[model samples]
Target: MTKSVIQPLETLRLAQYAVPIPCFVCGTDNMFDAEFCTHCSAPLALAHQADNKKVHPRLIAMVGPSAAGKTVYLGMLMDMLSRRPERMQMLARGAFSITLQQTTLAALARCAFPPKTPSEPERWNWVHCQMRRAGKRQTVEMIMPDMAGEALLEEVDHPHTYHLIRCFLEKCTGAMVLIDSIKLREGAREQDFFTMKLLSYLSELTSNDKAGWRKRPIALVLTKADQCRECMNDPAGYARTHAAGLWQHCQERFGRHKFFASGVAGTCAYRESMTEGRVQVPLRIEPHGVIEPFEWLLSELERSGKKS
Candidate 1:
């Protein structure tokens, strides 16, 4: 006697239920049936449901020459994102994208600078941050390639620089270009050349790509503003009077841009007294509007996404 064969569908009737997932933005455990994060109200793992789901997360590159305080600025920005009360609701959490992230963070924690060193050809550091704003959680990733001053100068003649620039520009939604105010004050001729070359390359990239690449927003960041109190006192006015030429150049090329001042170290100088042996005395480091540019970029992205 042949017994009736059980159907394959009937054999799988006792499948186990999938477990609830935790929110990537706010760490809230969400049931499999949930749609949004319960703690932060941000959509939990629902990129498919978002408007402009094809739109990639904005990449905010921090471009600057060596010793221009790029690493310090990043450290301070992360510090602000983690502790600033005003930004608490907006910031979710920040983490390093690679092993280098922790290394950089550790160096910053000690108020020491990164080794100013790279042993490999393709070394880079990146930080990934999840931010919440207007009931939406967006990720902001920053990429900083480890390049020496000499290497950057050589990049002008090499095709790799252009390749790197193109790769970064294609993925970026916005940018913050850091200019070393102290270097400018010291009359560094190399800095002037680097700035012009970098900007010109960016302009060419945007212009050649006629597919609306120029629409990406950019911010010209003047670092070490603490050394120039007069400039910090009236940042807008300073940009208009002193940075007018550069600003105009960027505006003509990029279509959307702004100028800003930032100082990561709250003092101007530091001195180690022999009498006290290891006691470090803080000098004139003043932090003024260091995070303003980033805040503006975030606002702009939020507005742009909302409109879409």
Candidate 2:
């Protein structure tokens, strides 16, 4: 004997896939249910959330060289804003957005720095959030990616090496270019040269006079400034003296840019490890100048919006 059961047709699911969704990073069309872009490998969650929320997000680039503290700085910034919530409030959009913040804070609690972001675009941590200032009815949707420094260098050295990065930077409203204050103070010229090249790449990315990078706001942030009092006090002066080449390039190429100094670890020490050789460990967390650069960038964006 055989039993027969009734089945329902799910044609609506097929209809959803019939319409193609464009990737947020590269704008490549993919099936509606696809998790990652086929061409760029960026998470499709960003596109889905943006579409469902009916808001277009502004992109902010947190760019720097390897070990320049991009991960630590961004994680700390997010935590601070969420905890305080008096001046500015940041609410994360999806579960994926919180991964960077969670990992960074977890590592800091253990007195260790978070691992470096991988060079592959698919492994990057992207943050999408809703931000609103106190006493304001308007809210802005923003997207920030914690991209690997080595990958960024590769893209700048050879154009189109990272298509996702190129597309994202071209759409960025503002950028925070971080340089290691300790490296600059120690007379390392590599940091200075890399930053100059990155700035040049941004300026040449677009030729439209109105929408070029020269017209957008940029913040040249000096990370790990706690070790250098001069950098903490006067970032512009420190850049002029130490990173003269970068300072001159910014002056000549970028029309709207400012200098900032930020530090997270109050003190750090080197420790030997059995598994991974020697590593640096933070003694305590004392953040300074963390929010100023971000605030300045937002204000500039708002100012530009009003002018237009």
Relative to the unseen true structure, what is the C-alpha lDDT of residue 76 in candidate 2, on a scale of 0 to 100? Answer: 93
Give per-model CA RMSD.
Answer: 10.6, 1.6
Worst 10 residues of 2 by lDDT: 132-141
lDDT of 2 at 75: 95
- What global local distance difference test value does model 2 have? 0.92
> Which parts of model 2 have CA positions greater than 4 angstroms off?
1-12
- Tell me the tens digit of each residue's lDDT in model 1 across 104-169: 566655665455644232444545445554444564433333334444445544635434444554
- In model 1, state the lDDT of residue 82: 59
- Give lDDT tens digits, candidate 2, residues 163-279: 988999999999999999989989999999999999989999998978999999999999998777789888999999999999999898889999999999989989999998999
lDDT of 1: 0.57
TM-score, candidate 1, is 0.65
How high is the CA lDDT of each candidate model? 0.57, 0.92
